[model samples]
Target: MTSVRVAGVGLTPFGDHGDRAGRDLFAEAAAAAIDDAEIDRAAVDQLAYGNFMGALAEQQGHQAPLMAEAAGLDCPATRYEEACASAGVAVKAAVEAIRAGTADLVVAGGMERMNCLDTGEATEALAIAADELYEVRAGMTFPSAYALMAQAYFDRFGGGRADLAHIAVKNHANAVPNEYAQYQREITVDDALDAPPVAEPLHLYDACPITDGASAVVLASEEYVTANDLDAPVEITGVGQGGDRLALQDRDAIAETPAATEAAEVAYADSGITAADIDVAEVHDCFTIAEAMALESLGIADSGEGIVAARDGKTTPDGDCPVNLSGGLKAKGHPVGATGGSQIAELTRLLRGDHPNSEHVADATTGVAHNAGGTVASAVVHVLEVAE
Candidate 1:
């Protein structure tokens, strides 16, 4: 199979875009990506887009063609939705298409608009990602679902809210230098501990904000890169996805995310690298505890030890393996469908030595991006190498 390179990437600042249309956000990101790639839009062979709640948010469906037109692209457009992992899977499809020789130049990304809706409306819309008959009916919102996971972790292991608070402080600090982050200011551990509780053990600072944003990536095959004389240096070497039961009740263990473990296992094997080889990472951190769980599942931290990875300075930017140099979904904002693409875009820039926080990992050669959907029911992992 031919290698796939991240030729270019674009992102709309992750925050509230008042009255902005989803397609409008996507168009800006896509155009920026195309411009960065220095490739004629005419060379694009396909478009893979992701949006989670267009129908509910804007009453607009059949968004693939609409986004393609908005982005000034004329090509076969496809939409992939796996909750918050939407854009990750979209990019994964782009990589597979190029690897299969079905297309060389493809645009993959996602957009999400949540600020347009009231908090209640947006929460209900997002709840559809869970099992409606089971989890949703029981009044289980994401904050609470994640709270259960936190409690499970504390029960099985031994940690408190103080441990999760460290993650919030670390991510917020990281976001200060990230132009695309939602919350770019630092917070103290005491501030996090004292913040209003969203759910027990998870305070306001511990959870990611509901955000509106978009991100896009231009990917090309190695053959296309050489043939077109592109200067792409970051290559997507591995992609893997795994799924678990949709309902939180059906899962065997709430504390452990088997899906992410499975996906990381496959991605690691595919990339011929282990977790120890990962110099940096950007994992889904919709909540502080989620990041801890992700670290464990991805093998960066052993079970029970993941909770304190941030507090121990292990996942800090100056630490052994910095995670979420883009601030992660925690302080970077969670625009649902768009976050996955944003993670990849941030990684591409960091690996390319263009990110504000790249100095932390200046000698890094390999990085990982992990995206997950609803309670870790869906997970997608990608491995990137500095091909330069």
Candidate 2:
């Protein structure tokens, strides 16, 4: 067995790229990551890429080989897609390959181009990630689905829109200094509350925007890192993936994400730590309610208690276990496939003391990244620790 080290991380700005092709975005991110790794480009043995809607957005179903060429790599490339968790699974596969001794170095990441599509086209494209027969045909957009979750939470757990707004405000504040973030301007709670309603309970401010971008990370085995003297300071100590009923109607509870809970538990066990050991987190916050759900799954908040954590000042930057210091998807931008890799990239920089938000978690030694697909029907969790 071998440890996986994140030798380098890179991300294109997480916002609209106008007419830039997906390949072009991925190429820039891959090049930046390879450059940051400071290793011979030829040493990279494989590429694990991810994209969710390339066929619809760019008419490219086979994105891995195209991206491999675009990134100027001469290695076998494989593509993984689990909707929003696409990059996460790709990274996990790259780690597994390194640990299995089948590869010494690998590049893992994802790219998404949503701004190119019209609003209706993009919504329809994203809806394909849901259950087509049950959810899509019934006209359940992500916002409406999350809104139902929020309503269910309020019905069962006793929180309201105000609580969720705090999460939006907190994440927006965190994004202000993040150069790659889409909406760096902070929003007040009132602003979030007053924003136009996308759904009953989820307002415009509560949801992540349609972003277009790419992110990449270079991974090396412990042996490769030592043999090459790579300056990698972040180690991926644990990885886990979990899945549940795909449709919300089939789930036991509409407000909870058991898949995320299962993934978090397994990842924590793999890392030889409990949830209490987590010092920071970057979670899937496609909607504000999702941040609460993720925190509960990670045990940062007790069941039914996550919704108020931000409002209560428990999950804020100065709190005991700060979360989403990169502003999260709520403000940092959610470029579908690229978001998972972006979370890991942001966490690596924060752990390495290079991110603008690092000061908030200066003493943090361990962190978690959680990504989910399709209302968290599928989820991936990874534990990262500063190298000893």
Candidate 3:
């Protein structure tokens, strides 16, 4: 298989992009990525875009071709929508194209304009990712779903809500330096613990906010990189995806996600690296409990010890293995489809030694991104390494 490299990455600050069309947001990100790659727009052979709720959020469909045109590129265009894991799926497709000798250069990314709707409407839009017949009908919003998981985790793992608060505190602190993060202010564990409840055990501070943003990456074949004299390309060493039943009620275990475990196993095997070898990571943390579950699912900690890992600072920037130095979804904001691409873009910056966060891992050479969709029903994991 031909090696695939991330030649450049770009992102728009995640926040309320008032009245900005999703295509326009994506176009900005795409142009920045192409410029960063030092490649002409004509060099891109295909575009793979991700957007989870364009039809609902913007009353728009068939966005791929529109985004391509907005980016000033005339190429084959495709869209991948796996809810929150949308951009990860798009990146996976771009990699496949490069590795199959089908295209030398592919522009892949995701965009979401979720703030266009009010909070209640946005919640309704997001609920569509769940099993409509089962979960949605049961009035299971995302926070409520994860709140159940949080309670189950405490019942099984012997930790309470305070342990989850530690995750919020750490991620908020990490977000302080991220200019692109939606919330840059730091918070305390008490702030998370005392905030009004969204769902019984989960507080207002425990969830990621509705965000509108876009992110893009320029992926190229190794041959193209060498021929174009690309600078400091980051190699996509491994890619893995897994899926499970969408409804949480049907799952055998609510505290742990088998899909994430399977995806991580495949990614590690493909990359020839283990969790212990990962110097840094960006795991999905749409809810604080989700972060703890992701740590265990990715094999960074034991099943019941994820909260302990966070409380002990093992996952902090100065810890042995830094996770979510970009503030994570907790503070960095979650734009659904765009989050997976944002994770890739952040990891690329970390590996390139240019991330704005002071907590960035020193001498980091390997990084992994864990993106999950719709209550962990789907997951995509990618391992990236600095080009040697």
Task: Please give the RMSD to the true structure for each candidate, in Å.
Answer: 0.7, 0.7, 0.9
Candidate with more favorable, higher TM-score: 2 or 3: 2
Looking at model 3, report the run of 10 residues with the lowest lDDT sum.
353-362
> Scored by Cα lDDT, where does model 1 land?
0.94
**1-388: candidate 3 lDDT, tens digit per residue:** 8889999999999999999889899999999889888998998999999999999999999999999999999999999999999999999999989989999999999999999999999999999999999889889999999999989888888888888898999999999999899999999888898899999789999899999999999999999999989984589989999999999999999989889999999989989899988888899999988988899988888889888777998998888788899999989999999999999999998888778863457688889999999999999999999878
- Estimate the TM-score of every prediction: 0.99, 0.99, 0.98
Give one digit per residue, the lDDT tens place, for model 1 in 1-388: 9999999999999999999999999999999999889898988999999889989998999999999999999999999899999999999999999999999999999999999999989989999999998889999999999999999989999999999999999999999999989999999999999999999989999889989999999999999999999989999999999899998889898999999999999999988999999999999999999999999988999999999999999999999999999999999999999988999999999999999999999999999999999999999999999996
Model 3, TM vs. native: 0.98
lDDT of 3 at 181: 97
lDDT for position 208 in model 3? 96
Candidate 1 similarity to native, TM-score: 0.99
lDDT of each: 0.94, 0.94, 0.91
Candidate 3's C-alpha runs over 4 A off are none
lDDT of 2 by residue, 1-388 (tens): 9899999999999999999999999999999999999988888899999889999999888899999999999999999999999999999999999999999999999999999999889989999999999999999988889888989988999998999999999999999999999999999999999999999889999999999999999999999999999999999999999999999999997889999999998998899989889999999999999999999999999999999999999989999989999999999999999988999999999999999999999999999999999899999999999989
On lDDT, the stronger of 1 and 3 is 1
